[model samples]
Target: MPAKWVRTFAERRPGVDVELVDCAAAEAAALVRSGTVDAALGRPGVNAEPDLALIRLYDEVPVVVVPKGHVLTAADELTCADLADESCLLPLDDVLGWDARPGTQLSHRPETTADAVELVAAGLGVLVVPMSLARLHHRRDLTFRPLVDGPAAPVGLWWSEPTSELVDEFIGVLRGRKAGSSRGTREPVAKRSAKEKAAARRERLEAAGKVPPRKPKGAGEPGARRRRGGR
Candidate 1:
């Protein structure tokens, strides 16, 4: 989605370029706060640091990942209490921060999500994570079912003070604003005159090869002298 938005922004502002910087969920807010990145896409709980502007995007659904043939797999969805007897491996860096984590606590928590997922795959425990994370480290031997009663992760756009035009432009794209919309453009282009509209359309057509290059004024008129005729 960010890539698509970048492309759209480039098409409108041809001189501007967007670069995505990868950061851990725990560090995303600090990266933006310290001016290391123009903006970040993350959830509010971890990425919404104080004084940073945030625009909530959407709610991310929660899911529980379990090995194949796990009893939870037999059901389409699960609740926290359903896995009370199972061991839950909680990474130290868990971003979701579920107030009600499922299952029993692990004897030793993993250090990161990848490690926890590995433990889950090894049948040491099951993990409750966002559906996106579950899909990120997907394995053929593992599958996830929705956690019907879990907290929904609220994802958002985070940026620090003195936001740039490019950041605002990307925000508009995420908000579904058209290129010519007032939020994106200083003035709407929809009210352009017919002549202005026709000229722009011709330029676009010429660029796209949908129409022949326009002839120079009077170049083919009957009385006009050809460039190389009778030479």
Candidate 2:
């Protein structure tokens, strides 16, 4: 979506390219510090590199995933105590802090959010994770409910102190800033007027031999005489 936004924004300006990279939070921060990548996106507070600047993008609430017919399916929000007797499936990395559950019996530890979701669908146990991860690994037979008092995960955009214009443009888009916002280094291209667009279309058609050449206008009609002389 960021790349798509960059492309749309660049349509009028031209000469812009957006590249997407995937790596661990630490690795991404290292890339930014080394100037390999202009910017990086990752979980907030995950990378504390000295030279990298972190910009908070948004916060995601943690949630609990259960099977469709499970007793908690109708719940709007769940608490850690609500899962006391239930076996909770947690990811191996524990990045979302699922292991920090106050009083729950963890029956299994899956390697990834995807694995946890699958376990939940198979009735192995319930899984606690960030709302985005739950949605990412959503299963047809499984549903999620927000954890009212659970930890909130913050997502952030990171970049070196001195970033390039292109990186700034991407950051602006991620922050939902307008095209002309100062936070974005690249200016939006001015839209062509209807008359100007039609004139350009006619020129293209004429060049393609699908339309006749337009008649020259009067000398006083702007630069018509100069254009005619050049032709």
Candidate 3:
């Protein structure tokens, strides 16, 4: 999805050279705040930080990748209960924050999801991750199934709130809001109302002596001035 966003952004902004930086979801906000990168795409809720403005792109469906011909593949989808007996291979960089204990927790944790995938291939345990990551590290012996009750990994475009025009353009691009005249777009001029237009026309006519001057309200009307009789 990040790749797709980058390609689309490049097509829309031909001049801009979008560079993809690989960092864990936890570290993306810090990298952006430190000015190492102009912007980043990560799970905003998972990596919430103060003063960082974010635009949510989309949510990634969670899937558990297991070895080919695994017994769990019987169902079209599985919940936390179905995974109770399996040893879930959890990496240090795991993004899915499950409230319920998912499967059997391993005593040793893998350093990364890629490492966990290797362990899964070696029949160590199953690894639950975003569908994107499953496809990313796809292998002939591995397959994934949707974990229906799992939390989604929401994608977001994050940067400093008061960012440069280029960064704002990228934000709009990710949001599908602009093709051109991107951010800081000028507001459309409002058309004059019928009453206002008529008033202006009457004023122009009166100024040119084309119509009689408007007179003050008579004494019968509300807020009318009383006559002094001496003047």
Q: Number of the top candidate by TM-score?
A: 1
Model 3 alpha-carbon drift over 4 Å, by segment: 180-231
- Tens digits of per-residue lDDT for model 1, 55-98: 88888888999999998898998988888899998898887887
lDDT of 3 at 122: 99
Candidate 3 is scored at a TM of 0.74
What TM-score against the true fold does each predicted structure earn? Answer: 0.77, 0.67, 0.74
The sequence of per-residue lDDT tens digits that candidate 3 reaches over residues 100-140 is 65888999999999999999999999999999889988999
lDDT of each: 0.84, 0.73, 0.82
TM-score of 1: 0.77
Candidate 2 per-residue lDDT over residues 99-133, each given as its tens digit? 36754656567777677778788888888777877
Distance from true position, residue 206, model 1, in Å? 26
Top candidate when judged by lDDT against the true structure = 1
Query: What pairs collide in candidate 3?
Result: none
Residue 105, model 2, lDDT: 52
* lDDT at residue 207 of model 3 (Cα atoms): 99
